[model samples]
Target: MEHSRIAVAGASGLIGAALVRSLAADGHEVVRLVRREPRTPDEVRWDPERKYVDPAGLAGCDAVVNLAGANVGSRRWTDAYKARIRDSRVLGTTALAEAVASLDRPPRVFVNGSAMGIYGETGDRAVDEDAPPGEGFLPELCVEWEGAAAPARAAGVRTVFTRTGLVVSREGGAWGRLFPLFKAGLGGRMGDGRQYWSFVSLHDEVAAIRHLIDTDGLSGPFNITAPHPLTNAEITAAMGRVLHRPTLFTVPAPVLRAVLGEMAGDVLGSQRVLPMRLLESGFTFAFPEIEEAIRAAK
Candidate 1:
């Protein structure tokens, strides 16, 4: 892909950091929109609560990717924290979208980050980008989260909701916590181990986002996951195999709920998501299997 000027919000996040490195490696000029005051040449300032962004800093950018949001699993789901989670995504996305839309030479595309939890519990049934949003908090939050980007779409900027899945990376995310436990042979399935997890390697996640940035014809929701979806038990086995450990233990559903509180529902919920749109667009995954993704994360 030819080098282009791209602005990225949430540049300090796990996925955002990876994307910045990827883009820079590819010779793209990346302007990181930070929450704090800009201290560097490539850093721009934005405040989500105030919905402020300096339009001059974003002018002439080819594309903008919004990944700003509170970490859902960062704390116990207190009502206040939950509100913070919702507000972070909605307000942050709205801020970025409105800013991008207002630019005199607005970005051609807005790659907004979303999640696979939008599908809720699907059991073994496979779903695609066209699948309707499911019930519960995550699905509801995702709906509002994606909706916050409407201004960009309405302004004629192609908006793509990158509905990402469980990204395998030891640096951060769900796997960050798992790596230590798994390495110590404490890794095990949470609940009956039947819940399907739609996962992708961190490498693939970054690559897919870059793909969307370069692909002009792609827009709207695109599921960013591997072709193979694995159940919790399968994932446990893959981790054990990759790390040369054992996966003979399991966490009961009730205990998981008691420990994780309401967030446990997502931990146990099954979502068999597919990348139908991504496949049709001719995008390829570097690690499409659970084992490969687990190994690659190391």
Candidate 2:
């Protein structure tokens, strides 16, 4: 792949930091957009809330990737926090999209961050990129989030939505919180453990993003998840087996709802997601199975 200048919003995030590193290491020039004043030569200032991005920062870039959003799993889903979650994604995406559209010489592609939550509760059915979004708060939020990139798409930029799944890693995110609990033998399945979790290793997650950036003739939504998804119970077993710990506990559905509030529905929901488009595009995963992903995180 040719080394290209790439501008990335949310470069401090878990995936963004990794991507910036991966790109820089591979000789790609990366311009990081920060909310604060730019400290480094490659850094630029942008206030997504106010819908402002330094167009000069994006000039002459091959691609623009936006991963800015308030983390859904970071806290309890109170009404205010829920609004923050929605606004952060929608507003930021709109800001970036508009900026990309305004550029006289636009980038070749725009890869906007998204999530598998758009599919809502898929239960036991296997769904792919072509499936219509499911109902409820998360799915609705995802729709608004992805739709915020309309300006870029309308401007003829090859926009791609990375409908990512649960990224497996030890640094941060949902799986990060589990490593400690499982090691202490306090880890167990949530609810009835029947809900499926579509997961991809952090390595694969960053790889898929780079793949989307580098590959030609790829646009629209791509499920950035491992092909094989496992039930919650199966995941629990894998955790225990990998850590040599006992999985003897379960967090009931009622308790989850009580603690997480509106967020619990997503915790217990099933999404047997398949990365059909990504697979068809010939992207191979470094960690395709739960055990393999877990070990990589370790």
Candidate 3:
């Protein structure tokens, strides 16, 4: 893509914030979809719940990326909070899909955010885009979340869903919380540390989205993960080595369940996903190893 105009939802988030900066630095015209009243010409007001977005703001954009959603690990998952997590993704996606569909000239591509959680509890299996979704709240929610973008797909727009992995970054997300703990020598593996954690650096995550936008003749779900997936224990060891801390502590699964409620299932579950489709499409990762990603995050 040659410095094309791009519209982004969820511009305030960790991935969204970095993606916006990366796109702007590369000279792409960036427009942010905000929940608040428009603060500038580049910001557009939108209400996902109300299914309203000023289509004029998105007109003639080369691509529209939707990353709007609630943070899964932000708090203990109460029933209401779980509903918010689901609504935040599905409703926001539906709203954006409908808005883009209504445009006379929709974006050439729609890159919507997804997660590896869709293939719930893959154990030690290294799955990719072709794997079927496993059973669980997260899996079912992911199916619905991706399906929410039907309006855009139905409108003949080239739509893609990025099944992103655990983004390793110090700014925010799950790894952000782990950085401080590891720096203070309090970090350790959760549960027995056997579960796999598919991860990608923040740089790679942003780069993959741009690749999806630029690459043509590609649609459907793509795993935005590193080629190699490591178990939690391995990641703990890497963190200890990178931060010069001891990885001697362990958090039992029972304690995690008691504290995180239903969300503990995700924390202890395994999904050894790989970026098979992404690599085949010619997207390269700058930090494919755990150590390199940890060092970059630091």
Candidate 3 CA-lDDT value = 0.93
RMSD of 3: 0.8
Sort by lDDT, best first: what order?
2, 3, 1
How much does each candidate deviate from the true structure in C-alpha RMSD?
A: 0.9, 0.8, 0.8
The models' CA-based lDDT, in order, is 0.91, 0.94, 0.93
When 1 and 2 are scored with TM-score, the better candidate is: 2
* Tens digits of per-residue lDDT for model 2, 125-173: 9999999999998899999999999999999999999999999998888
Q: Residue 40 deviation, candidate 3, in Å?
A: 0.3
Per-residue lDDT of 225-268 in model 1, one digit per residue for the tens?
Answer: 99999999989998999999997778899998888888888789
TM-score per candidate, in order?
A: 0.98, 0.99, 0.98
In model 3, which regions exceed 4 Å deviation? none
Model 3 TM-score (2 dp) = 0.98
Clashing pairs in 1: none
